[model samples]
Target: MASFDVESLFTNVPLHETTELIVNNLNISHLDKFGLDKVHFRKLLGITAHHSVFCFDDCLYTQTDGVAMGPPLGPSYANAFLCHHEQDWLEQCPLEFKPLHYRRYIDDTFLLFKHPSHVNLFLDYLNSKHPSIKFSCEMQKDNQLPFLDTMVTNNNGIFHTTKERLAWEPRLTIGSMREPTPFHEARLVSGANSFGRHCQWVTGLQVLRSQSLRCSHLDFVRNTGKRTIIERHRATRC
Candidate 1:
C-alpha cells in the first residue's frame, strides 16, 4: 500500500478552469435537485468561486490561480475538482497495476496495489497525470502507514487498524457538563464509539513482532477513560 498527499490542494487548483469544467460536464436534468437551471447554476458556481484577493505581508499583493483557503466552500470545491481530475487517471490506468483498494479523504489518498513490484511505476504514473496537482507518497514501512486517524497495517496479507499518533490528542468532551450544550453529550457518545471501534480492531492483531500494544493504544485507553469517567461524574452532579 502507498499513500500520498496533494500539496497545497486549495491554493494550487485553477478555480475558474475547474468551475468551467464542472459546469460544462454537469447533467442538466439533475439541476432541479438544487432548484436551478443550467444558466443559474453556472452563474451561482462562478459567483461563489474565489477570484483575485489582496494579501499583505510587508506590502499588498493579489493571489492568482487556486481558491483562497479559510472559507468552508474552498475545500468542498477543490475536492470536487481534484476528484474529477483523478478519475481520468484511474480510468486510463493499466489493468496489471490497478489499485485493489483506493481510499481518499479530501487531498490525502491511500492506494493498495495487488502486485507490490509495480507500485513505483504506478506511483510515477499517478504523479504524471496532472502537472499542477502533484502527489507525494509515503513508501510502505514494515507494511504499515498512517491514513486519516488510523494506522493501516498489512500483516502478511491481512489488514489491521492501529491508532494514529497525531500532533494533538482527541477530546472526550468539548465542554463542561454545566455548559448546557448538546456538544458535550455528542462528544461523550462519540468517545465511547471510538473506544469500542479501537478495541474491536486490536482484539486479535499484534502491533509489532514482539508486542501487542503501542504507546498510542495505552494513551487512547488512559485518556478516553479519564475524560469519559470525569465527564460522567460531572453529568451526574448536574
Candidate 2:
C-alpha cells in the first residue's frame, strides 16, 4: 500500500492545455444538440479557466500559473485533466510495473504498488509527464500508510482504517481559538473518487467529526466512497 499527493496541484495545472483536452473529450453529439460546437465550447472553457482573480492577505493577485483553488470548477477541471494523462500513461505502461489498484480523490492518490525497486521509477515517470505536476509518495511502513486523514492497513486483500491527526492540525488550535468553524467549512476539503480497473479490494470505515456536524450527512469510507460499513467487503465497482 502506498499514497501519492500532488504538490501544489491546483496552482500547477496548465489552463489552456486542460481546456482544450476537456472540450475535445466532451461528446460532440450532445454538445451539438445544445448549440455548442467544439470550437465555441473550447472558447468558453478557455475564458472561464483563465479568468480567475482573488485577493489574499489584502493583496490582489491574478493567478497566471494554473487553476485557482477555491472556485467550483477547480476540482472538476483538474480531475478531468488528470484522467486524460492517466489514461494515456496506462495504455503504454508495462503490466508488471503497473499498480494493482489506483484510487484518487482530487490531488491525493492511494494505490497498491508492490514492487519495491520500481516505486521510485513510477514516481519519476509521473513527474516526467508534465513539467509542473509532481508527486510525493509514502510507501507502507510496518503495514501502514497514511493517506490524508486516514491510516490504512492492508492485510492480504482486506483493509482497515483509522483517522489520523496531522501534525499541523495541533498548531491550528493555538491561542484559545477554540470556536467551532461553520458547517460549510467541511466543503473546503471535499471529494470522493475511487478507481480500480481489475482489483478486488476490501475496507473498513469510521467517521469522526471535530465538532458536531450541522448537516444530516451520509457516511463515508476511506478507500472507497460507497459502502459505509466498517468491515471487510469488496469495494464498489467504479
Candidate 3:
C-alpha cells in the first residue's frame, strides 16, 4: 500500500482546470439548485480565479494561475478539479499502475497495489498528469501505514482498517461517553490541535465519529475483550 500527498494543492490548482471542472459539475437543469445560469457562474468563477492578488515583500502581485487558498469556494473548486484528473487517470493510465484499493481524503490519498513496483509507476503517472499538481508517495513499511484516522494493514490479500496505534485526545466526548476523534475527519481536523477551535463545524462518514472496531467483529472481541457494537446506525464498518 502507498500513501500520496498532493504538494501545494490549492495554490497550484491551475485556474483553467478549476473553472472547467466547476462548470462541468454545475449542471444547467439544476438552475433552481444553484440559482444561476451556467455561463454566468463560469464568468463569475473566472473573475474570482484570475483577479486574486496578494502582497509579498511589500509588493502587490496578481496571481496568474491556480485558485487562491482563502475563498470559501477554494476547497470545493480544488476538490472538483483534482477529482476530475483522478477519474481521467483511472481510465487512461496503464492497468499495472492501477491501485487495488484507493481512498482519498481531500489532498491525502492512500492506494493499495498488487506489486510494490507499480507504486513508482503510478506516482510517475500522477505527477505527469499536471505540472502544477504533483504527488509525493510513501510505501508501507513492515506491512502497515497510517492513513486518515486509522492504521491500514495488509494481511495476505485481505485489507484491514484499525486504530490500534492511532493518536487521540484525552478529553473528547460523544453523547454520554467520552472519546476522541483520531486523524483526518475528511481533513476537517487534518492539522488541528482541537477539533472545534482549529477548524469549522463539520461532519463526515461514521468513521469520523467512531473508528472503534475493525472489519471483523470477531477480531474486535479477541483484541479488546468486549462485545462489538454498532457505530452510528450501521453494523458494518465504514
Candidate 4:
C-alpha cells in the first residue's frame, strides 16, 4: 500500500537554504608590537613573582646529614610572610571594615568587601602592606572590579558567567524571566510539517519520472523487432 494520500494538499512550500548579502567587510588589524599569541600574553600579564624570604644559610642549616629535615616548611614560611603583610595592611584600613572573605594562592590574592567604602579601605590597606606590588584599577567602573573570572562590585555583589572566546561579547541580564508561548510551539510544528511535505513531494516526483522512463523503454523494445528480424534473416539464408 502507498503511504502518502495524494488527495491531501500542502499550502506552504519550504525553502531548504537561505542566502544573505553583506555590504561591507569588517575585519580589524592587529595593533600590538610583540605579536605574541593570546595565551602567551595572558600568561605574561597574569604572572606575579613572590621571592622566598628564607636565606640560603638558614635552609642549609635546616637540612640533615642524609635527608633534609624540619618538616618541609616552605609553605609555612610563605604563609607567615603573607600573614605579616596582611596584618600590617589591616591596621591602616580607612573604612573601619575588613574583608569578609580572603583567598590567596601563591602571589594571587582575592579580597571581598561589603560596600564601596570597604573597597577603598582594602585598596589603601593593599598599598600600605605591599608597597612593592603595583595595583591597577583602570578597568573598574561604578565601584565594580574584575577579580579572576568574576565581577566584584561595591554593593557586596558578585557576578559570574561562562568563559567565552576572545571575539565574543557578553549579554547580561539583571532580573528577568520569560514564559513559553503557544506561538513558539506552533511555529516549530509548522516548520517540521512543511519540511516533511517537501521531502515527500520531491521523492514522489523522482520515483514517478524513473517509472515513466522504464515503461517507455519497455514499449520501445516491444515495438522494434530487431532481434527477431536478424534471426529470421539468418534462417532464410541457411
Count of clashing pairs, candidate 1: 0
Q: Please give the distance, in angstroms, between residue 201's alpha carbon in candidate 3 and its true position after superposition.
A: 23
Number of the top lDDT candidate: 3
C-alpha positional error of residue 51 in candidate 2 after TM-score superposition, expressed in Å = 1.3
- lDDT against true structure, model 2: 0.60
How well is each residue in 190-233 modelled by candidate 3, as lDDT tens digits? Answer: 21223233122122212223454345334544666644232322
Across residues 17-36, which tens digit of lDDT does each residue of candidate 2 receive? 88776766666665655566
**For model 1, what is the C-alpha lDDT against the true structure?**
0.60
| Candidate 2 weakest lDDT stretch, 10 residues | 197-206
Q: What TM-score quantifies how close candidate 4 is to the native fold? A: 0.28
Off by over 4 Å in 4: 1-80, 91-95, 130-134, 137-145, 149-161, 164-238
| Tens digit per residue, CA lDDT, model 4, 88-163 | 5555555566766555432345555565456655554565543334333223466555443345555535444333
Q: List the lowest-lDDT window of 10 residues for candidate 4.
A: 14-23
Following a full C-alpha superposition, what root-mean-square deviation does model 2 have from the true structure?
Answer: 19.4
Q: Where in model 1 is the C-alpha error above 4 Å?
A: 29-35, 58-60, 167-238
Q: Which regions of candidate 3 are displaced past 4 Å?
A: 162-238
